[model samples]
Target: MLHVAPSPAVAGNRHRRQMLLPWLDAEGQRRIRESTVLISRVGGLGGPLAQSLAVAGVGRIVLFHEGALLDEDLHRMVLMHPERVGEPRGSQAAETLRRLGGPHLEVHGFDHRITEDEATRWMREADIAVGAAPTYEERLLLNDAALAAGKPFVDAAMYDDETHVLCVDAGKSGCLRCLVPEPPPWRADFPVLAAVSAMVGNLAASLALRILAGAGPIPWGELVHFDAARIELTRVRVPRSAGCPACAAAERTSR
Candidate 1:
């Protein structure tokens, strides 16, 4: 169903040959190359997540985030540069990914926050939607859009030394709204360490690749939590909410 032409340079496949071994075959790699991913935010969690997908040869990536780069952002945002502090974070992240991912990778950077209309349109274009926004409102908006479009949504979050990642398969798994129910009290400035965020981001990226490439079974509807201080990883299944308006709408559309 997905078709992607190889780059003119032989180096494209050659560049990713290391991953083509025991697990991912040539066909699997092609699937990954043809898929498009939508990542919300280029902050700590989303930055490394997008970078991992780009390096793994995901063909197209759409990034949505608002505001200019702050000097404080550099503490955890790996894709940002100190010189581009006043510039838009989304555009800067796109530039960084382009340089790291080479010529064949297509990266679209929106320097503003995504509106409801934009979310609907972009989710339709994305094979998978990743939410790493700092706010629950943005994450829930993305979740609704992804469910409406019947696309898989990956949610990544970090608070202090704790990291959480969840994958939602529309019509098959519990959605973000089901997990959070209502937005909890959250601060704009949350404590996070670079290493902790990157670890969680990479974990989210791995899960996305598995879904896109059909490389392995994905733990859909399960929330994965990692505590850096405790040095432990745990998984718990999340139940679909019967009263979730977003999920209810998605269900109605599917019928």
Candidate 2:
């Protein structure tokens, strides 16, 4: 059911030509071309992640982000333009992706954040969900939606020079709620570097591509941490919390 369309010829497409590696062959590329990914926020982290997916041939992207662009957001929002300031961030991001991905890629841009009431409806249209919101509330909402829809979820976040990426495969892996049972205190104006945000976003994109293409075993439930300060990358398994209300409720429903 994931591969909804027939595989298109990849012969002369320059964007996908370079991606033809042993790990991701023509069939893999076709899979990528048919997948629809939902991104929670098209800001710092989500900007690069959506751009990478667009260029890599994702068939569609659903973007959700509230508010108009501010001058301060340009430092890390790669898809946003200075001229587009005061414009809706979601629509601007969608326009940028459409320009990059050409006519084949479809993008639905919402000028508001995904609400609890709308989560299930949106999740039904996506094959996977990626969360890059600054707030734990949004990330956890996305996690619950993805789990309920039986879709993979990737949680990407960064603070200053440090980055964190978590890939969850619904019932098979721990959800975001498992790692943070209660919402942690976080600031909306978190400090971040452009380069570090892009690095983590691209990393999350790569993980997403692997999952979409079925290239290899997914690192589900693993927390990938990158410390730009020390130039270190670490991976640790996140054990599923037995008391996680989000995933636990999902597990019970599956039975």
Candidate 3:
């Protein structure tokens, strides 16, 4: 069953956007057509990222966000138009994405919070997960889900002018656990401008497709940071810790 625009209740046409998404070869496109990604929220960074993923032709995108759209969110998550201001965020994003793309893309909007169990379930169905949530609480839950489900993940964050996309391999590549041994610095209002969010989020979506299609020499488990304010780009090694919780946990369970 395919996902369509305006998100009709019926399953969409399977071969709708066969011509677009030319980044991959025939085989790569074929793989994308068969893949599924579960994005936690379709707000802020996740909005454009999910849209690009749909445009790039991910088979299905299961979106989970619990609230309705607020007038304030229209600033950065521009997909939510004034008309859909009061609708469920996930529904609005799904509708907009479907309309922008086509039925070949599948967008499932869940009106529930992404709890631990829910995250794991979504990760189970996803080839890779993208964590663009604004909080470390969400990131940690995402990490556990990816690790337990053995799915690769891409963690992206934006703070005003600076943004980064960190690719995670659960137990293989340095997961988020490697970078921060303790809780991430909690920011009540993460300083992310729309421009910076769009830049980094799109990169995350781009890298997600590359990982899925096995395209070129993949830059897996690397931290790509961009300071849009300064027009700078930095590639840093994804740090791994000897006592990282996820890695140590995986090893302990394996042993």
Candidate 4:
């Protein structure tokens, strides 16, 4: 549920441009204002994702990323600056988001990875969950938590020169586990370019907003892939695996 207040007058002045859109009038903008999004790992993809959602006027954003900023992260992590290279990424990101998001938007940052116990609480509280972690282990954890809490999960990833954006609508869509039951055998670290990550991050945010506001024809269980080298975009529908542990369990319980 969105944390919306029944205000007679909409704050159209702040988001006038968005309000002007035919689908997103005062009511739609208000929906965005009342929504809460939980974004995990505010590094390459998470950085721009948080920024885009803030600009879109999402009511609240809760970010999770544990570690200090690295010099290398400056290239892709938009929330990071060279001056804060050694500072905590979560705190730095939260502070930056608060400033960029203005006073109306609520921002919370956790400097440690969300525990299994904490995952459900945060997922249930938020209207949406985004997985932007660099490792498949972390991404899988987020998927489990989001599914358990009955929240939609948006995943964005960039590898080499290719990027993938996917959204899992819990029971209705194929989840991360459904797509990849096991983590890839390759090492976690990979080559990344800021330009590519930022572009994919913005697309992920756009999909999230569409799902949240019910404004556009969201992909739902589809995967949106981008190949920067070839400059091509592809959409592929992903089907749910009947044997998927996480989603399969949910299905059995519901029936």
Model number with the top TM-score? 1
lDDT tens digits, residues 138-202, model 4? 88888888887777889999998899988988777898899889999888578999888888999
Put down candidate 3 lDDT per residue, 172-248, tens digits, no spaces.
77877687655765656766678779888898898888888877555567788888979999988876778777776
Give the whole-model CA lDDT for all candidates, comma-separated: 0.85, 0.85, 0.76, 0.83
Whole-structure CA lDDT of model 1: 0.85
Off by over 4 Å in 2: 1-11, 252-255
- Model 3 weakest 10-residue run by lDDT: 1-10
Q: Write the per-residue lDDT of candidate 2 for residues 2-56, one digit (tens) a residue.
A: 1122234342565555465767888888898889898899898999999999888
Q: What is the per-residue lDDT of model 1 for residues 150-180, given as tens digits with 9 covering 90 to 100?
A: 8889999999889899999887789889999
Model 1: per-residue Cα lDDT at residue 141: 91
Instruction: Name the runs in model 3 displaced over 4 angstroms.
Output: 1-23, 249-255
Show model 1 residue runs off by greater than 4 Å.
1-10
User: Candidate 3 vs. truth: CA RMSD?
Assistant: 3.9
Query: Which is the winner by TM-score between candidate 1 and candidate 2?
Result: 1
Look at candidate 1 and tell me the lDDT of residue 74.
91
Which pairs of residues collide in candidate 4? none
